[model samples]
Target chain A: MTQVVALSGGIGGAKLALGLQHILPPGELTVAVNTGDDFEHLGLSISPDIDTVLYTLAGLANPELSWGRAGDSWNFMAEIERLGGENWYRLGDKDLALHIERTRRLNAGEKLTGITADFARHFGVLGRVVPMSNDLVRTMVITDEGTLDFQHYFVERRCEPVVKGFAYAGAADARLPAQLQEDLQDPSLQAIVICPSNPWLSIAPILEIPAWREALLEVTAPVIAVSPLVNGQAVKGPITKIMSELQLELSSASIARFYEGIIDGFVIDKSEAHVAPEIAVATHVTGTPMKTPVDKQRLAREVLEFARSFGKL
Target chain B: MTQVVALSGGIGGAKLALGLQHILPPGELTVAVNTGDDFEHLGLSISPDIDTVLYTLAGLANPELSWGRAGDSWNFMAEIERLGGENWYRLGDKDLALHIERTRRLNAGEKLTGITADFARHFGVLGRVVPMSNDLVRTMVITDEGTLDFQHYFVERRCEPVVKGFAYAGAADARLPAQLQEDLQDPSLQAIVICPSNPWLSIAPILEIPAWREALLEVTAPVIAVSPLVNGQAVKGPITKIMSELQLELSSASIARFYEGIIDGFVIDKSEAHVAPEIAVATHVTGTPMKTPVDKQRLAREVLEFARSFGKL
Candidate 1:
């Protein structure tokens, strides 16, 4: 009867979401993905984080590409480029179906929550995957080159622009999706696992939402955040670079500090065990590098065990 | 330099558009395609007739499929079906590129005319491919099953429903694209060739536009129409069925009668020579069956010669 709510971004977070989905029973885990990275590209409402979680949970993600559908072809992108279309944000042939369908449904007055649930059900994904909010909430990255949308800063520029700050546009106005509010209020809920995604770009946007933040602060369930950093560098992506650019310490402790008031415990890699004492909340030192299937489940088990050690068991 | 303005729909019309492009110098021909067949599919603006003209002129059309880009894959459609998305109207992988780009540009405030011209330039199309108007004009087919959108009636239902009537929604209010207006007023404009396409479904949409019709009616150029039928049967598609359903004779003379005042001459297949005497307008008997590589060019020459014979030569 245990239920969990996991917060995730794209690629790296999806890896952890995959781990948790594998460890938990079907319909038990609820992955609330960041909608900060969602943008309108070629008239498509692309929820990068939501799609990653969906693909990861459904086991449709390409192992090599790290995102998008498995065995997806580049015929669509190739033709777009040939026709002088914007090909920077490549939508693979198979991957494009999700964007198109999602956009279509969204345009037809369906909420993001319903569409995500429907897509997951179709793909036979274990557990539930929901967007942090049904309302529009975009992450605008303030960089040396000026403010750019999340995808333009990330995918189009390859995260090259030096980060100054980030603005969670519409987060203040964005309300929690009804189902997520009900899920958060459920007395049977065990813990909220924050996946190892970029804290500023991924988790911050979700936490910035007033209703979502208020729900997490008021919920009885333990909220645990895993560090995206291994030691002083990111496992992948520009987390380290962005952290340094923002004049923050490049360590798991800094990441733990970022989520200080919101999270109950912090999970860091065993390599950063020395920083465990620095974290104000209870800490779990585990092998968080989810390279293999065993690694993901092992890390997931350890995190849950750590949460249970706080008198819940 | 002979300047032509060819009116077209899709598939069957594209063949003659290609033939005109092959015989005429680059930029000498302007294929004003029907916007009636155009619709928003999955939030992407799809100009079926315009794309057909573009592909045919660019030599990128699939010879086997009679539609879509050459060697385009169906991975996108397959994935859409798997995701429980609408798959009735199939948009191929490579073929989807144009729709996406055009949709993007249109949302960004670009006109269909500019986008079509840009796409044609990108593909190195010999002749200009332009939508009939920048404004929207959708075809509504009133059938026994009810009035359905053109694509829903044609692609989804495979034109099985009995035809009752047709409506060119927005056609009356739609104005001709500026370039088309200028082309119509050109002193060197030799002729206007209406390609062999469905009269009610294709040409009617373009002709229904008051400004476009007036331009053709008052232009100092010859207007010639190519019969879509061989004897009493269409070369491809459900033209014969729709004609019979509409309580009209399945003959080329009936088609010529439909274009009575607008067209100066009618080009019929040699097999339909028997019906030529029945046509009110001056008639030219030629090989209208554009089945072979030579057939298209040969038919193109015959139509052009027929047009030139009316004082232009």
Candidate 2:
């Protein structure tokens, strides 16, 4: 009966969201998606992270990619290619429609948080979906090569560039959505699960918002973070690589250290269970290899069960 | 070689532009395209008339549709559909690249005319293509149902709406591109030919620019208009249907009467040779059905030959 808030980014986070969606009652779960990776492409405002979470929750996500609509066509992108535009991003025709509608609504003066809420409601999604911020904030990776936009670093350039650090460009000006702020104050807000998303990239931006960290400090619920990195490697994406590039120890201990004072518990992959005793905070180990929907749900349920034990705290 | 300017909209006008391009020496022809049909769709500023003329001139127009790029693909549009976006306008993937790039550049502060000129130049088009006005102007249809945007009437609804009147919403404030105004004043500018495009919907918008009629009147060169309606029928599109809906006669005589003193010569299709004599204007009969590249060139040659006969008039 506890209302759970899951902070998420794109793929890795979406897996956890799908898992949470499976165990939690529809209205009891709220997934707050990162918008720092959102940018305008072909005049359409595209929220990569928000879309990934939406698609995964809607059961329309590509099974292999864990993003975009399954069975999506690329006719629109083919037309774009013929016109000599950027063909690198690979916008599926169906996916382009969402971007178009999102852009249309956004340009018409609708806040992105409201638009995402409406989109989630329209897609028959039972759980609440919220954007991290309504303001325009872009995640930029400060690499040895140069400062690059998140999509450029993640999608276009394939994260090959060495990350020196990352900056959430507009986080200083962003404010937590009113509902998100209110939910943090709710007595029923029993848990805040930071999905095993990339530390510096995904969770960092959410925490970077000027009031976001302060608001999380205000919540009475235990703040738990799941480690995206385990056994000296990332379960997915550039988390471990970025961690190493930033000269941090690439281990569950390092992830805990990264979130040190802010979190009450750290969830690591069962593969890294040996290192659990070394973590400075309370630690829980689970089978976090989310390769399947079943894997995602199992990991999510295990995390929830672990958090419930902390009700004694 | 006498320099000539032709005012045009989509298919029918592209045909005359093709004809004029073939006969005129390099730089002798300037095709001023209608921009009133332009509107922002999915955040991209789409100029239908400008693109149609550009594609037709670039030798990349789809032969079947007589608009968009030749051999165009639809991967992008397919993707859009998969995402549950509007699939009404089939923006070919290849063709979409141009719109996307143009929209990007436009948003970056490039003028519509400059962006179009760059596209034309890059495509190796020799004839100068100028937008009738640099300003944003949209044509709206006041129908029995309601006032609808041009694309809504033309594409989405497939021209099924009953129109009461048409309004060029921004024409009263639109200024003719300075280059075009200077062209009108050039002594070497020998003739002005209005291509056989839809009079009420296409040509009327260009003419509606408050200073346009005066500019046309001040020009010493002969102003000629080609009849889109031949033997009481249009070569393509809703010209006849729309004309009839607005309670106007669908005939070459009506077209001639429509241009009365504004034109010195009226080019009628050979099929409507009988009606040419009724109007008190210099009229010529010619082959105007431009179906192929050769047809476009040949028509351009004939129109030029007819205009050359009145040189220095």
Candidate 3:
């Protein structure tokens, strides 16, 4: 049974997932990565979030850019740009192979989970990396410009469009991977850590799946969420901008409130510690900006210790 | 009016094609590259010969390696190997973009000819690059082991399999692109140059196409072939090995004989000048190994000058 299950989107989420995997025993962690951000570009199936988690756990994450693989080359993108092909979504040279291989496997009738897990093994990642679901769960951004595919809205448009709301296009029909479902039911499972990622764009896509949500809800393990924001600002990505655009309060309490019925505990940054008292469930405050290895490990330890204080929900 | 139409496969063919394109008036030369070597790999439509011609004419051909784009990175193939992918067919990082973009455009319903022309323009190529046919024509190699796809036989197996014969799947059904049909019919067209690519592997696929061969034969321009062999040896690629395996005489006369009734002229090497008498058509002998820009230009000039001496038959 997996001791820790961290669920969230790319970059930021991958950080915490790496920390958990490192601190836990080998194979003790399961990082259920959001596949909503996956899209077909230039006839390639790209799962950005899943690759982030895989790269991070494999110690291949690009420390310079805080995303993609370490030492990843951009020759592929350069040639794509030169050829007047789709150049908005950047694909690094080394990273391209993974996408191509994954797409090939998927086309060969293998599930995304199997392909991801196999890639994780090949990458020498310590823990398992699985997609939220085998089925497509596109995160469609309902922006003022128009409804856009997640990549088109986020990458191509540079998230410039004013947000109205979001939708998980295939979430209603998606089912949790059978192994993941079985893992969630295991009593040895300690907690579900929803890492600091975009709530509407990343976590919600996974949550919108009725089967996954019900299975997660049935699990006795406490579900904890770490605030993606520090000092009421996102450590990375467009979280704060999205919140402001959505007319939501720029505070950790607002983030906690969004997961009201789902999470058993919430961990905010020291800057937003004041808002913790306003939360209904248990809450903890810590410095959550994961820049270095120590930063990630410290935060991971803090989250785990926080979860230990409460009994299984 | 197009001055020259060169037909052949990769590397050796691309060398002469580059020479013709460089010497002729910009856009006067047309390169009809073999699509028989094209195949769906990693779900991307890969046109090996077309890309070779495109890269060669664009001043992007790898000078040292003599294939793919210049300064092409291998990180993609390296990572593919690491991920246990089908890495036998080496796809350079820069070359990958062409395959992907071509595949994407094809999926969007664009014809290969239109894509090739557009790619040629984008490459700043002096000459027009074209597929022999818009339809898929896969070259299947019959070997001692079994039948193998062109790429499988050429790249994966490294041509170790003893060749029995070859077949161009879909060649009979494929039609000439309308623009090419019109180009061939143009009264002002000059000679057709058969580049020094393998007669069986490179030139045969195009010849197998009924429409293209018929249109080519109906043209008033003289049809001439430049020997891929010099000193009874291939300048590049598997001509000698395949010829020996297929039990054919490994000489320029044999190459010219393969094109029997279709050609009015042939060019052999100075070393193979003796065999010129065996060929019925007008044969020109010169140092045909294209090592430098001067060599390519010299050969191109010779082929055109020879064509001009003859009346359109």
Best by TM-score: 3
lDDT of 1 by residue, A1-313 (tens): 4388989999888888888889898888899999999998877888888988898889989888767888889998988888877778878999999999998899889999999999999999987999999999989999999999889999989999999999999999999998899899888888889999999999999999999899999988889999988977888889989988989878899999999899998999988998888899999887789899898888888888777777552
Candidate 3 chain B lowest-lDDT run of ten: B179-188
Candidate 2 lDDT at B96 equals: 70
lDDT of 2 by residue, A41-145 (tens): 766688988998988888878876756878876665765555556777877755666776788788889888788887787677767789998987889999999
Comparing 1 and 2 by TM-score, which wins?
Answer: 1
Q: Give Cα-based local distance difference scores for all models.
A: 0.89, 0.82, 0.88
lDDT value, residue A165 of candidate 2: 88
Error of 1 at B201 (Å): 1.6
Predicted structure 3: clash tally: 0
Residue A259 CA displacement from its true place in model 1, Å: 2.0
- Per-residue accuracy of model 3 over B1-313 as CA lDDT, tens digit each: 7878888789998888888977899878888889999999988899988998898888898888757888888998999889988877889998999988998899899999999998988889989888998988889999999999999999898899999999989999998888778778777788899999888998999999999889777889999998888887887778999999878898888898899989988998899998988998999989899889999999999999999888774
Residue-level lDDT tens digits of model 1 in B1-313 = 3389999999889999888888998889989999898888888889888887888888889888767888899999998898887888889999999998888899899999999999999999878888899988989999999999999999999999999999999998999998999888888898899999989998999999999989999988899999999978998888899889888888998899899999999999888999978999899998898887689998888888888899853
What fraction of the real A-B contacts shows up in model 3? 0.91
Kindly report the root-mean-square deviation of model 1 from the true structure over all alpha carbons: 1.8
Error of 3 at B281 (Å): 1.3
For this target, which candidate reaches the highest DockQ against the unseen true structure?
3
DockQ of each: 0.83, 0.41, 0.85
CA lDDT for candidate 1:
0.89
Whichever of 1 and 3 has more lDDT, that candidate is: 1
